[model samples]
Target: MPLNTRILLDNRPRGEASVSNFRIETVETPPLAEGQVLVRHHYLSLDPYMRGRMNDAKSYAEPQPLGEVMIGGTVGEVVESRHPRYAPGDQVVGMGGWQQYSVVDASQPGALRKVDTTHVPLSHYLGAVGMPGVTAWYGLVKIIDPKPGQTVTVSAASGAVGSAVGALAKARGCRVVGIAGGPDKCAYVKDELGFDDCIDYRQHRDYPSLAKALKQACPHGIDGHFENVGGMVLDAVMLRTNPFARMAVCGMIAGYDGQPLPMANPALILINRLRVEGFIVSEHMEVWPEALAELAELVGSGRFRPRETVAHGIESAPEAFLGLLKGRNFGKQLVKLV
Candidate 1:
């Protein structure tokens, strides 16, 4: 039996997660059942949504029980396979959790997507070409169909999803404004990604002033809003939304752990005639091929660039996750297990 090190939730986090919340324990890899494959984790995708899984609160997905291996998505290489469909050395992406190895049944819905790393880096399968990239595409193309000359605003603008959205909007001929935490992130969005403007929300004392800044950035009110950090930011954006403006609510990283409360923005939503919709990335998985093609072409042509902030080693996963919640990650955050 293969010995694997896994990070398990030792205690539920109080507000923010720390190393203390996780315990690294060694365990034996379970014997592969029929149609199951054993995989050695190569890369782990550390996302903000995992914060919700750390608690026992009600959410779209179940919370991780104490002593249970923390849930995550990973890119791995199959080491042992009892399943005919998979074989040794096959690289695949799936819900593997924060562990050195995992056993996956091929029949599951999120079993794995086989990857060809000779063309693209295998890590890209867990980053730009994977979940975060897909989220940005579907939210922008399917949900918010930005038109030429329209003003587009993306919160958490320097992160993976935000950057992708801004680049896609710019490619579509729409003026994009990114709202991030600090000057460095703002500069990256404006100067590097070619966003028309960027707002450093941390420098702004009040949401009203932030709203004014956004208004100034957008001489015309925002035509579409990609909400990543909800709460006050959503409230501020809602105050200046154009009529028929669409909002793709991707995440609420602001309230994920600190405080669990519904934001007060319905009055503004009604007044501005905004259409806000919350969607899970999985909801649009079937249509991913089309989005992936466009994104891949843009990437290949150098039109779209993905920024990634990577933390090395499985031991760094907790800190990396906390960094994501604190907006410390510049782009998509990942942990290299190998």
Candidate 2:
């Protein structure tokens, strides 16, 4: 029997997550029951949302159980199968977690799906063409719905979801401004990702400073926004939004540390008459097909180029994930298990 190396959540973090919060162990692979298939994960996605799942608190999803494999999206190949729908060597994408292999049951809805790596790379299914891409599509297309020539802003603009949002907004002929951590990310957001302008949030640590930079970048008041880092960034973007503007609230990474980070200007929501909406991309599964098709096309045609920060081996998953939360990993962060 093959040994399966699994990384489990050892301790819930009091504030920011550390490597000590995780535990890695190897065990003999469990036998697959009827309707189960054995998958060998090649790549595991490390996303910021996983940070929210770490805390034992109320959230959109259940808290990640302690002593279990940390939940995550995995792209893998079926090495063995007892399920009729799956066969040997079939590439798949599923919630395989921080383990080298998973025995997924076919009866689980939306749990396992086959993927074709012929045109798009297998790792992309974990990022651009997968969850993050769909997340960008949902927020921009469904929520913001920016018009051509309108000015739109995105926080954490160099990340996977934000990068996609900027590019898609550009395709729609909108003036896109990105708020990122530093100069290099700002440069990549503007030069490579094609955002109209990029603001380095690090330079402007305070709300007033960020507001000034945003004002300079967006000469015209922002008409739409894709909110990623919620605390200060949201406060800054809100100050410059036009009346009747739309904002899609995606993630509030600042408060993920169990801090009660309040909005500096909640009144702006009312004063600007902004239509702010918060969404989880997974709950809206209806749009995945459409979103994936368009994203795959864009990626395949070179119109949409999604970058990645690859960490080698399953053991690296914990450190890589911690880096993602701190904005250390550029683009999409992934652990290459193979």
Candidate 3:
């Protein structure tokens, strides 16, 4: 039997997550049952949403069970299979978790899906062409519903989902302004991602400074907002939004450390009549096909260039994930298992 190395959630985080919250162990792979396929993970996606799962709280999803393989999206190749739909050596993407291998039953709906890696790389499926890309599409296309020549501002502008959102919004002829943490990320967001303007939020720590920057960058006022970092950043954007503007609230990484970070200006939602909606991408599966098709085409054509920050091995996942929560990652954070 082959040895399967797995990372388990050892402790639920009280505030911020640390390396001690996880444990790595090796175990023997059990025999595959009928209609089951085994996959060897090549890459594991580390996302901000995983941080919310670390806390034992009431949310959209249940807290990740203790001492179990940490849940994650993985792109891998099928190594062994008894399922009729999948064969050995087929590339697949699934919820393989923070583990080297996964045995998935083919009988379950959406348990496993085959991916074509001829034009696109396998790891891209875990980042730009996969969940994050779909997330961008759902927020920008469905919720924000941006119009041409409108101004759109995105928080955490250099992140996986935010980067995609900015690019997609720009493609639709919207004036895109990005709010990132540093000069380097801001430069990339403006120069590489083609955002009309990029704000280094580190330079504007307080609401006054941030709001002033937003006013200067978006003189026409923000028509749409793709909010990833909520807290003070949201407050700044709220003050600059045009009347009847729309906002897609995807994440609130600022409050992930158990901090009570409330909106500084909730009145804007009512007074400005802004349409703000929060969403979890997993809840909307119907749009995946349309979103993935457009994303794949854009990525394949070099139009939608999504960047990634990769950690070399599974052991680096803990530190990599922690760094991601701290905005240390440049783009999409990934752990290369192979």
TM-score for all models, in order of appearance: 0.94, 0.98, 0.99
Per-residue accuracy of model 2 over 122-188 as CA lDDT, tens digit each: 9999989999999999999999999999999999899999999988899899999999998999999
Residue 289 of model 1, lDDT score: 85
- lDDT winner among the candidates? 3
The Cα local distance difference test for each model comes to 0.86, 0.92, 0.93
**lDDT of candidate 3 over 1-338, digit per residue (tens):** 47999999999887889999999999998999999999999999999989998888999999999999999999999999999999999999999999899999977998898999888889999888899999999999999999999999999999999999988998899999999999999999988888999999999769979999999999999999999998889999999999999999999999988999878889989999999999999999999999999889888888878889999888899999999999999999999998
Candidate 2: residue 73 lDDT (0-100): 97
TM-score of 3: 0.99
**Best prediction by TM-score:** 3
What does candidate 1's lDDT look like per residue over 208-275, in tens digits? 88888888898999999999988878878887799999999999988887686466667877787788
lDDT of 2 at 331: 94
Scanning candidate 2 in windows of ten residues, the lowest lDDT window is 254-263
Question: Clash pairs of candidate 3?
Answer: none
